[model samples]
Target: MNDHWENMARQGSRFFGKMTASLSHEIKNALAIINEKAGLLEDFTLMAEQGRGMDPKRLKSLAGDIMKQIQRADGLVKRLNRFAHSADEWVRTVELEEALALILSIAHRPASMREAVLEAEPASTPLQVTTKPFLLENMIWACIEFFLSENQKRIRLIPEKTSDGVRIRFVGDLPLPESSGLLFPGEAEKVLLRALGAELRMKPATGEMVLHLPKGP
Candidate 1:
């Protein structure tokens, strides 16, 4: 049990590190856009000072672009902050849709970079579960990373309530490998899911992966 927990801790650390790195890159890209826009605004002002009449529409457009990037950065930071706090508790009640949304947000940068679309199939009702939020999220990320690593173009998450608990279907076109090592490299994802009292199943024929989570810890 001690070794099991130690492994989880290590895995959690790696997940946090990878997520933070991706989030930082996203922020950097947003800042770069803002910087470029600001530079263009400065050039416009210089032209105005040189008696080159400024186009009001162009100035307004430039300002709008900068504001848009600022808003984008703000949203990313809020999501990153929420993710950072998920580690504060060992286990908590988490709304399934909300949790999955955060995972998708954090994974957006990498997914977009790979030109893969990550979407959640709309749920008619809320699915809530009590579990280790951070660990559960890491497990989801592991599954997503596996498919994204394989160059899969589209991944969809479908959440629904089960009689006993909740089920989240990870649907994509990439098939899961036969070997456990290939499906879950390093066995870290397996351990994390097991620790969360969740069951994972993959259908190679249909390229569907399912995660069954209990109602409570």
Candidate 2:
């Protein structure tokens, strides 16, 4: 186990370092393009081409739009990169709220594409537990994907600290079929639950699926 963990750590570290360097260069190139465009706009205003000056208000609006896109892109890259580095540690205590937040970030684009809304209420207190971060993320993603397939357009994630560990309640807008378990917690999900020392329960009447995890995986 020690050797395996070290190997994973070394590989993940190298992967993250290389990706960060590459993305830094990419962002630099992007910013260079934006700067050139802005400079051209300024020159147009200065030359007042054809005796018509560029509108300062329009220029400011365009710049604001560009900045917003840049900020959004930066945020997405950070969340995904942090998630990718999750394997750097084989096992550790993780804050459940933070984990759900990252998973939601990853699922946001897909949910949007499907015209679905995903929301998560911040837990009042941290729900911390020891687990395999990457697998936990995988399970959460699977849950999100599974629940999204239902007719309900809005899916909510509620995090709670269980007496023995942590629980994340995935609630749906419509009442779920009691046989929902027949569709989810399938063979693969069961494997994940087993490995994580977790349990998945269906609450049909309440329209929710609860994932119960122990203090350690």
Top-scoring candidate (lDDT): 1
For residues 1-217, what per-residue lDDT tens digits would candidate 1 score against the true structure? 8888889989999999999999888899999999999899989989989999988999999989999999999988998999999989998999999999999989987899899999998888978999999999999999888878767789999999999999899888676566634555456876887888898887766677788999987
Clash counts per candidate, in order, are: 0, 0
Once all C-alphas are superposed, what RMSD does model 2 give against the true structure? 5.9
Q: What is the TM-score of each candidate against the true structure?
A: 0.92, 0.78
Any runs in candidate 2 off by more than 4 Å, and if so which?
Answer: 1-51
**Minimal lDDT window, size 10, model 2:** 11-20
lDDT of each: 0.88, 0.77
* lDDT at position 54, candidate 2: 75
Leading candidate by TM-score: 1
Q: How would you encode candidate 2's per-residue C-alpha lDDT over 94-193 as one tens digit per residue?
A: 9888888887766765677688899999887967989988778878877887877876688999998878988999998888888898998765667667
Q: What are the runs in model 1 whose C-alpha is more than 4 Å off?
A: 180-182
Candidate 2 displacement at residue 119 in angstroms: 1.2
